[model samples]
Target: MMRRERLRTSESPDGRKVATWRLVRSGARILRVQDRADASPAYRWPGREPLPLGAPGLVLFDELAPPDLATVREAFPGCLDLWNAVREDFWHALLDTSDLPASGTKG
Candidate 1:
């Protein structure tokens, strides 16, 4: 089976970056564009597993750090619909988890 991996980056309070290469074994709902968004356009496999939290890791950025829809779309075409769907899902999920009504509906 072809192994799929995802890159996750987090910054510490200080001016340091830590990158993690997560082994995304399987997830049907996980969007493919997420991979493009997390890593640079010329991303390549690091040839090894990520280091521990205390250890250093390589940090990579997409074409744009905080990519806008246009940037993301430009990087990977035909992702507009997918992006919108994911955004809507996240919005609704946030509302549901926060126990908030769906705007027009009263709880």
Candidate 2:
């Protein structure tokens, strides 16, 4: 069976952290990209089990040292819009690949 892993990273400018749920199959390919938009920096993971489907994955802030949500919102009010565009771009790219199986089963 395949397993899922959660990878977290913070972006600059508005130091809001983003979490991505990835699944690594038997090979080195990435399988899934689940975004969490409400995760906090204080949350800790055991690195043993997969994150729940409804768990928070990403956090948006303005600073790394002391995240300022208001600042983030002020600076990047369209962040969610941009994020959604990027996600769509990625999905389209994956679908454009010819190597993907005919059954539409991606791995």
Which 10-residue window in model 1 sums to the lowest lDDT? Answer: 23-32
Runs in model 2 lying further than 4 Å from the true structure: 1-40, 44-82, 102-107
Per-candidate TM-scores read 0.27, 0.24
Which tens-of-lDDT digit does each residue in 1-107 have in candidate 2? 31132222223234443323222222112222223454523222222234444345533221223222233334445555434443443344434535445574665
Q: What is the lDDT of candidate 1?
A: 0.34
Residue 34 CA displacement from its true place in model 1, Å: 5.6
Reference-based lDDT, residue 62, model 2: 19
Query: Which prediction has the highest TM-score against the true structure?
Result: 1
Per candidate, the number of residue pairs that clash is 0, 3
**Candidate 1 structure quality by residue, lDDT tens digits, 9-58:** 22222323222222232211221232323333333222233324312233
Q: How accurate locally is residue 74 in candidate 2, as Cα lDDT from 0 to 100?
A: 48
Model 2: how far residue 6 lies from native, Å: 12
